[model samples]
Structures are given as structure tokens and as C-alpha cells.
Target: MAEGRLQRELNRRNPFETPEQEAVLNLLRTGDLILNRFGRLFGEHNITDSQYNVLKILRDEGQPMPSLGIAGRMVQVVPAITGLIDRLEAKELVVRRRCVQDRRVVYVEITPLGTKLLAELDQPVLALHKQMVGKLSQPEVKQLSRLLEKAREVFSQ
Candidate 1:
């Protein structure tokens, strides 16, 4: 039957035409899977991955930063940062203040509540990082990270 022939052909020929294409597809698929897992983990604590990223960035800076500065640090657009800040502010995780000297500029600062939540998330976040790439040896992880960094360099142009 035609079905049998199709099955035979499929079995004879590999699904991917080239190793490079297969590797790229595999990398994208794996990244999606890992991100999904991380999303669920973060959602359990009432935050999305992006929200956590914003909080962590603010924490690391150790001081309030201009809204544009935060947007620059993030991959998101400038306008979207306003909505994101609104949501975080609504949740009492962060507060926004207008710069006294420059009324046009707004600064975002993480609240104490945000700091407490981040501290709570620390253990689980570290565990998730370990679990995601734990199978790889340290050298392998370092090499993989280096390769990925190099791959990103192409986009900077």
C-alpha cells in the first residue's frame, strides 16, 4: 500500500536534511522546554520570568534606576516597560518615583516586599539552574556557554 511505501521511505531517510539544521532545531526545542519549566516554577510564586528578571536587575543595581535604564537592560521595548512597571507596582513589588530634578524621568525601585520575595526565590532558582544543566560537567557547561555567547555575537552586527 501507499502507506507502507511512505513508512519505508521515512525509515530509510533521516528526518533532517543536514546536521546543522538538526542541531539548531534541537537547541530551539530544548530552550523552549527549559523555559516552560522555569515559567511554571516562577508562576507558582506569583511572578513571571520577566518580572523576576526585572526585580533581580533592580536588586543588583542596589539603587533606583531610570525607567529607560531598566528597559535598556531588558530586551523589551521602552513603552512596554511602563506597563510592566505598572503591574509590579500594583502588586506592591516595586515603586516608581518621578525624578525631582527631571520631572520627565521616572525611577523604579524595588520594594522591601520585592526583596523578601527574591530572597525566598533564591534557593529554588539556584536549584532549577542546577537541575537544568546539572548533567553536564563544569567544563562542558563553560564550553557550551562560551559557544552560545559566540553564537550571539553574530547578532550584534
Candidate 2:
């Protein structure tokens, strides 16, 4: 049998038990490698991937967002959002305010500094994305996105 790239990379002595397992492992390995690249980029700017994500979400919303709302959109658990917010707040990247009507509720708004940081990162991030998948043609990229969206739908249901 011909050696697959992943098999050679892993230096596996035996073949995968099944194609399904092999595909899943390949997807995970690819994601981890890509994430590591992004991690280094984010590190240079003194923020983790999660922090960048939070700031980006707030920027996209165009208004102050509730803590729970931000938490809902994060990959991390809800409890983790608090610590993430605290760090961003300490850096003056975000400001937290109590809700006017519901004091129990906290709203977070990105600072101009945060917006500036994201703006600076925009080009590098785009370049990184292109670098990661530049080998794939436009059509293949679109198809891959469609396939990923379909795969995610299973979890939504």
C-alpha cells in the first residue's frame, strides 16, 4: 500500500484501522497546526486566540454586548469568559458597565485601543489564511466551507 502523508508524518508502523478514523485524525492534525500558526501571531501582539476572538465579536456587534452573549459565542465554557474579560479589561482593551435597567447584567464594549489592535492584525490574519489554504482553488475553498457548515449542522440539531 502507498504511504499517506499523515502516516509518514506520524511514522506509523501500521495502517489506520478505518478511513473514517484516518479522516478525523487528519482534520484534527490540520486544525492544530493552523491554530499553532495563529497562536504565534497572536502572541506577538500579546493576546491569546480567545482574546482576539472576543474583541472581534464585540467589534462585529457594533455595540456593547452582554457577558453571557459573548460567552455564548465562545468555544470556551461560560465560566471561562469572566477570566478572559478580566484580562482584556486590565489591558484597557474593553470596558465593562452595569446594565441601566438590570444592574445584575454586565455589558462589555471594546475600547478604541482594541479596535486599533484588530485593525492592525487584519492584514496579517488575512495573509495567514491565504497562506494556509492558498493551494486550494477558489472553488475548492467554497466547497470546503460548505462541507464544514453541513458537518456542523449535525451538532446544531
Best by lDDT: 2
Q: Over the full model, what C-alpha lDDT does candidate 2 score relative to the true structure? A: 0.94
Q: TM-scores of the models, in the given order?
A: 0.87, 0.95
Candidate 2 lDDT for residue 69: 97
Scanning candidate 2 in windows of ten residues, the lowest lDDT window is 15-24
- Poorly placed runs, candidate 1 (over 4 Å): 1-14
- The count of backbone overlaps in candidate 1 is 0
Clashes within 3 Å, all models in order: 0, 0
What are the per-residue Cα lDDT tens digits for candidate 1 across 3-116?
A: 233335446554565667656766786798799998999999999888998999999999999999998899898898888889999999999999999999999999999999
TM-score of 2: 0.95
Q: Check candidate 1 and list the clashing pairs.
A: none
List the lowest-lDDT window of 10 residues for candidate 1: 1-10
- Report RMSD (Å) for each prediction in the order shown: 5.4, 1.2
